[model samples]
Target: MDTKTFGQTRLLKACAACSVVAALLGCAAPAAQYYPDEEQAIEDEVGAALPPGSAIVEFTTNSAAVAAFQQRVGDKLCEPDAQHIAARVRRREIPSEVQQNFRGLANFLSLGALAQIEKLPKTKIAHYPANQPIAFAATAYITDGTCGPLFLQFTPQAAKRYSLSMDFNGQSCRLGIREMDESTQTRPVKHSRWRCAEGFLGIGKPTLIGPDEIN
Candidate 1:
């Protein structure tokens, strides 16, 4: 090729490379700001969920209550006749405060680590209740594999109602019910219907389903 033609070609290539770099930098800018903003929001929510000086009780894998609850869920999910029920029943949407807690906690873990969290045989329950007993638990599971926690808050009434909340990576669900067999001696004979909302780690639309429907 001629010298002039070669020089022009080099100049064009350099300009193209610069343009590509500029485009990448532009895209990265929003993400850089986005992460910090999200992190701050999460922190604010966590503070609200477990405020300063709030009392909390932690339950390990060995806890009989935790073991029974896990087995109860496992039995339903393993049933051959089990159906993939959509979140719907009494249909209680999760409070914004609870949603924020999951988002904040998950922000600290990567997708791979989240998956491992779900499948771990044991669950760690952190009970923090107001007016009634509230328990928050984390477990590892396979499916969309991720490490996420579940929240269960009981009501003070005689019938005893429960608000079961969970965040699976970005997938979140909150189920509310009047009662579930709390007896530790046996698996629940009857299923509890819950109204739930599913979305990205605490953000989504509400639906209804039985507690056994959660996976």
Candidate 2:
């Protein structure tokens, strides 16, 4: 390659790098209000532990990609504006207002050591209603994008510890739910495949829904 050609190649690479950095540092997404303040978080956390309440679910997503866990609001199945257990962006990537608003059960994530994480340094946790069967719509996203949301459901027992996980290997992803036994043992919970009466992959967004939800 001639010197001029080599210089042009370098310029192109530089522009691409700039675009990525701009997206990373400046393009953080909007987040929902999980906990309003410390006092409310405490009350909610305590209430969740009692019978006919929520169960503690520790989340450990071991993947370079970031994913979201959205619980159905009341009976609004597969609604776009569901409650976010974890926003699609990592906690490290969350904007300042979210940092101040969430605590206790909602204060489970605090990782910002890397501009882009290889994997979260440790597990992040969450609390969800356990009085009845619950389900979440999950979607994974990477530097490029990801396959669309799929459904995950389990009947969480009160006072029991639960841990959920997701793994994304570039081409595909996997989600798992387990009923944790006294914080020591984990047993997998199997259910019939999820049924969503409707589906939509946000166009031009980070998710591109496949023909089916399993990805």
Per-residue error (Å), model 1, residue 147:
9.5
Clash count of each predicted structure: 21, 0
Query: Candidate 1 residues 120-189, lDDT tens each?
Result: 3222223333354332223322222322223232323332322232222223322222223456221211
- What tens-digit string does per-residue lDDT give for candidate 2 at 1-215? 11000000001223344344435433354532222222121112333345356677665454435666677556445444457565333323223443334322122232332333423332555566766766666666654455445566566776777766655544666666666885478675543235343334534423322223322
Structure candidate 2, residue pairs in collision: none
The TM-score obtained by model 1 is: 0.21
Q: What stretches of model 2 exceed 4 Å from their correct place?
A: 1-19, 22-53, 85-122, 190-192, 195-215
Question: Native-vs-model 1 lDDT?
Answer: 0.27
Evaluate model 2: give its lDDT: 0.47
Stretches > 4 Å off in candidate 1:
1-56, 62-130, 133-139, 143-151, 155-204, 208-215
